[model samples]
Target chain A: MIDLSQTISSNTIVYTLDMVGVAACTIAATILAKRLQFDVLGAFFVSFLGSVGGGTLRDLLLNRHPIFWLHDLNYIHFIIGLSLIVQIFYHYVERLDKALRWFDALGLAAFTVIGVESALSRNMSAPIVMLMGVFTAIIGGVFRDIVCRQIPLVLQKEIYITASLVGSVYYLLLLQTGINEWLRSISTLLLIFSVRMLAVYRGWNLPDITLQPKEKQK
Target chain B: MIDLSQTISSNTIVYTLDMVGVAACTIAATILAKRLQFDVLGAFFVSFLGSVGGGTLRDLLLNRHPIFWLHDLNYIHFIIGLSLIVQIFYHYVERLDKALRWFDALGLAAFTVIGVESALSRNMSAPIVMLMGVFTAIIGGVFRDIVCRQIPLVLQKEIYITASLVGSVYYLLLLQTGINEWLRSISTLLLIFSVRMLAVYRGWNLPDITLQPKEKQK
Candidate 1:
């Protein structure tokens, strides 16, 4: 049986490591997205967004002080490490983009769950929790997209944010049933990933509500 | 003498118009920066950051409610206007790049003074207000540079942040002396613009903290 205190300690360790993973994954995603034209500095910005943007937004919303970063400089080291990794592994990502797609989905799923759970622990309202979940899922990518000068995926005509919303709500509902923590974590991750993957595969999109152009032009 | 309330109102109008000017300047900035082959979506992203990123970050730190755009949809309209202006009047900016450079400096000066006023109005400490002033002045350009795949102006050994810091401190010093708002604003703006322009012309940069390799790589 895993002791609860040990579980908490282990989770913290894993989270910090996973943050580094986010940085690395962000670099891979941007490199692939931009087709190798993104330079070292661009890769660094993407990695920073991938690793830190989501958590930073979460902390800001929760009114947490010092941020996860302003206190410990480990994240800075992680970003540097990830940037070097990209410099070394550029060819590998270019040659194998498909596998990285799946990797990106898994990363997104894991991050969504973590964000939603963090909000719930702070006793946020359900809507706020869901918003937090969506914010967490997209902010890193959104920041990356902004820095990359691309339309944010959330604003794109796709089911991206919707999939995140569905998964967040499902996870919260399951929690009400007294599910085991580990199982809940795994299952929610699976749910978010599958839903998102399916949505992407299907080209699902929300209804467009574009404002019609006013007359008076030629 | 100007009525105090009318003066405040006029400043607010100027503040709002400056926001629009910032937006227009951003879109124009990106179109020029990416005159080479580029992703158009990324261009809009750069415009968005250059227009709103600084103020948004300021609000986030200040713990204000309903971020500026969320409160009034005018910012959204401003963005649309920028996009349209770029699509139509881009050639003009290209023709005037040399002259427009000074306009960019003016925008920076105006933004730094306005940023200091905003922070001080929120009752932030002088140091924190100065920091906010510097942040607002540089973040937009820093963001634009990163997305354009270049080192940020401040990070590139430029005098960008230095100008903002000087201007902000000067603004505070003026306030301490009971200087009238209009004169104080003009002096601060001139100080920031002159310092920044002089540094750019002179190629001034703080020394880079270089570290020699302890061991040579083969």
Candidate 2:
């Protein structure tokens, strides 16, 4: 397994962006937990799961040790502090739904890029890398929805995973062009963020697959 | 990290029991998929998740490499073969629900023991070991339920996780007695199986926690 500590510590920009993603995910989850009438403990639990579930799964799949959150205590401290703040100012937080969605889109883009980078560093296959990217971008929300007993929005005709996949593929192709690394990463992030935001704005959805014909056609 | 390959390979009984547990989980998940009106591919997917989800999470959290299923291809082959067989004989398989529940209980017991043993081999702390045992035994079913868009039974006040936790603690205590390994394992397995079966038969449930009073709620 690749040692990620040095890589994670050396990249200040990536580290900062990753924490922003974590904060966004935690806030979104806390809002959902409130909607579900969960207690503070439940909200905190869901927020933690939402913030770290994806990266944790990715790290585990790649056989990385200590897990990211466990390796860095700041992740836990940040999540707890943010969750408590959200809980304290829930009335104000609830009104930030629209803003939260945009933040979540930003998070999704950042997470996808980070996941792709992590997989590429390990020299994983293209398909695996792309999969890790999508997993990192969306699995946290899936986990939060599951615990809240709701069908995950991404699994329910949303274009969310598609955005992550597109960005990951775009990033991979850009690598071949020998472009500036910073520009490549930023462009991929913007592409994903734009796709996700436009999908939400246009109310775009993937066509649903009907398992059986409704009541036998005449 | 402890190399479990040799330990898993040398223990014929444990290996056989683990496969049996996998088969049982797959069959149960297949039955659930049929109820959910999922297609063949969906059923196969759910079965795979149900059979391996818990163990995968346990291995990942413990930083075990290669993952148990990837380490042994028989797990994949067995799950596919069993799932296909169940799908082919859906009508007949549907009648075996009662039998399947018993098999699942047995599987839960076996998986808990296996997880505890794996953690113990690594010298994990007691709480972590016990938590790993429960995660190995139930997370698969949790994943299956989540994918199917249902509230997981274990999270809905069921005694399922309790049985696994009890069995794990029992196994840990049994080690203190310096008993024969086989006897210790078998007794722990029986304890868990009996607890689960009895809970099902008696309709035992954990008490629900209400956040607020109904009249003053919201």
Best prediction by lDDT: 2
Q: List the lowest-lDDT window of 10 residues for candidate 2 chain B.
A: B206-215
The positional error of residue B201 in candidate 2, measured at the CA in angstroms, is: 2.7
**Per-residue lDDT tens digits of candidate 2, residues A108-176?**
999998899989988999999999999998999888887888778887777899999999999999989
Where does candidate 1 clash, by residue pair? A149-B42, A150-B42
Q: Residue A4's C-alpha lDDT in candidate 1?
A: 83
Q: What is the per-residue lDDT of model 2 for residues B156-193, given as tens digits with 9 covering 90 to 100?
A: 44578788889999999998997877788889889999
Range of the 10 consecutive residues with the lowest summed lDDT in candidate 2 chain A: A36-45
Model 2: residues with Cα > 4 Å off, grouped in runs = A1-48, A58-63, A69-139, A146-218, B1-10, B36-42, B211-218
Q: Compared with the true structure, what per-residue lDDT tens digits does model 1 show for residues A139-186?
A: 787666665666454544556666677888888899789777767777
lDDT of 2 at B46: 98
* Overall lDDT per candidate, in order of appearance: 0.68, 0.84
DockQ of each: 0.06, 0.12
Clashes of each: 2, 0
Docking class of 1: incorrect
